[model samples]
Target: MRAGDTAPILAVPLLLLAALPAMGFADWLTLSASGLAMGMLLFLMASGLTLIFGLMDVLNFTHGAFVGFGAFIAASVWARLPGLVAAPGLAANLLALAAAGGAAALVCGGLGLAFERVVIRRVYGAHLRQILITVGAMIVAEQMSVVIWGPDALTLAKPASLASSFIVAGGAVEKFRLVAAALGLAAFAALRLVLARTRIGLVVRAGVEDREMVEALGYRVRRLFVFVFAVGTALAGLGGAMWAVYAGTVTAGLGGELTVLLFTVVVIGGLGSVSGSFLGALLVGLITNYVGFLAPKLALLANVALMAGVLLWRPRGLLPLVRT
Candidate 1:
């Protein structure tokens, strides 16, 4: 669908007229920024899958658990940083937030590596078995997190300093929200640099191309597999941490069945490419954010329709880097 295919284009003029000149521009700009910010977060979460599928050829179903785990950890730490110290303000809160996110990444990464070593290794290249195991793992992880952290939803607050919202065109948005978006974009750029420029990334690319060959050439691909899994888990953790701040809650199972939605992004973006995931996520994010403006009932259609159209046109995905 082009510009003409959308009702938003038609509605924009009328909405502008209704709002007057200055109000319309401000409103549009703020909405667009929010959309972009949301898109960036999607990109962060989807990036993990891109690498996992790209390098390992594994369709992990339990990836979302890492995200939920991260969210829980972040929410708990952010909301309770004062308890950790006599006086917890902006600096302490930031440190706690970082610590929470970092700790979640570590914990998730460790679990990922262990899963890779203990169970995933046996499946090797078995996609079907991997699917079964991953689904089971997801259920177990979700339930275990609930048991450990309980079923209650918890709020994640930004520090009073950071939580403040700045007025943009008469509307206010949280500073933490903007920071989270910027962080996601920065992470993507860093990831691109790592994959394209570093030795670790070169090996990752090589491993993606031919795991057997990479192993046969004496480069322990098993270690690489672990690395990819850990990295994927870490990204999930970061996504969770950011989500906690954005959604203002740390409820269990936040990433529960959403693995399917993430997979949709991965497939539509391309199975094994970072750039593809980033592009797909941004598109999905924008659609999700702006679709409401196009008559609330037809809103969700934006994401679904965009995905369907992409898959229809590119069955292997938009940037099918790998034949899979």
Candidate 2:
């Protein structure tokens, strides 16, 4: 990819940030920003899922559990160490919050790797069996989360300074959500760069296209699979942390239909396609935001309708290319 192509991706959030000041607070800017923010988080989570199932061909039914686990971790940190998160200075607070994110991602990565080795590895290529195993694992993980965190819903706390909401046109946009949106965009850019410019990315791309050949060439395909799995799970974990930070809450809804909608976004974007994921995300983001206002009763229905239209019209997804 050329630098010119990369420049536009880097420019989107900049453009959005610039537009923020011009819009009336009540004007749809807050909803647009929030929708994009949530959409970006979905992009992060779905990127990992698509890569695992689309490329490495691993069925990770427990991916949501990883996100839930990460959210719980961030929630715990904020609940325990409010001082560090609320500390003054952008650099310091960002660093501290990033540390918390790193911890959550790494923990989730370890769990994902272990699960792949002990459980998912056994069912490679067996979609039916993989589904069963993953579903079972999901059950176990859900039960564990509830047991540890209790049945009550827990809300994450933003630093006192960030919890403040600004009036935008008649709407309210939280300061912390703006930060989350910016960070989420950064994560999207970083993931794109990794896939486009790195050697591991090349191997991952190749593995997705032809794992048998990659392994026959004396490459450690299993290790590559494990790496991809870990990365995907970590992204989901990061999304969880970001969500906890943005929404200030954690609940078992992580494994139910809410989780299914996320997966649907992944599918609509096309499995294992990074650029496709972002594009699909923007579409879903816009649809969800606008439909909620026009037909509040069918907000979820709107997203589903959009996905169905894409699937029925293009079964393989809008973008179906595997760069090897």
Candidate 3:
């Protein structure tokens, strides 16, 4: 990549430096930790969409449904295992979280398979129809959630072990946020490893570059599509589960509310680029936290401003994988 190409990566460090003078070092550290945690959550929510959007070429508005489902399902897990969730033991807390995340992934992954077969298969290459049908599906799914879980917002308290903060360099960093950041980094590294070093990754990348050619090579591209879609939704569900834990609440509309931010991350990071999405998410997370703290009123507009600015400076996003 050219230096010009890598310039966008500097935005995070520069943003960090820019904020130091505005607050005390400890305050800055706390906010930075918060921002990092939020960014990772955003990345978790948006990363799967990036894979589907870039690899599948399908416009799936129902992606939010998976997120909502993930959140509610995870909440249900915690509700059922109140003992484990509330236990002061770290092992019990970790078990509760693992179960919740696993359930979310499993349920959402199954839903993704059904979605790919019933809805997405028919609308291949048709953006408008894909948008309409998927959105309608999302609405239906949301209503189903209401029927099953009710319309009330559900709260997901962090497990006892992750509920407190520890002092780090005179700043208190929430243990949960630190865990989120670590998980996000692990997910990113895993994705990079799979996409760059494995045979399935090679095939997926090839499919992204030339689907017809892959099919012609007898690679069963259709199955590949289904696999991608399933995995994408699963990731989104996992992200949703984590987000519910982070935010302490999950509503029927949680996924819908996050859709805008997910798209912003996808767009700014480049439509199909995971690495680009990572950077875009960090920029957004930090920008929102800093601006929300510095200028409360602009919080709503902070992400949009960042998106617009990035687009004006690099219309193709930080690392656009596919040329339009």
Q: Please, what is the TM-score per model?
A: 0.85, 0.86, 0.96
| lDDT-best of 1 and 3 | 3
Candidate 3 residues 1-324, lDDT tens each?
235576788888999999999988988999999998899878877788888888778878888889889999999998999999899999999899889989998999999999899889999999999999988998898899999999999998789999999888888899989888888888888888899999998888777767788878889878887998898888888888888898899898888888888889999998778889899888888988889999999998999999999899889788888542
By TM-score, the better pick of 1 and 3 is 3
Prediction 1 TM-score vs. true: 0.85
Overlapping backbone residue pairs in candidate 1 total 0
Please give, for residues 105-151, the per-residue lDDT of candidate 1 as tens digits: 88778877888888778886899999999889888988888898888
Looking at model 3, how many pairs of residues clash?
A: 0
Residue 27 lDDT, candidate 3, scale 0-100:
81
Which segments of model 3 are wrong by more than 4 Å? Answer: 1-4, 322-324
Worst 10 residues of 3 by lDDT: 1-10
**Cα lDDT computed for each candidate against the true fold:** 0.74, 0.75, 0.87
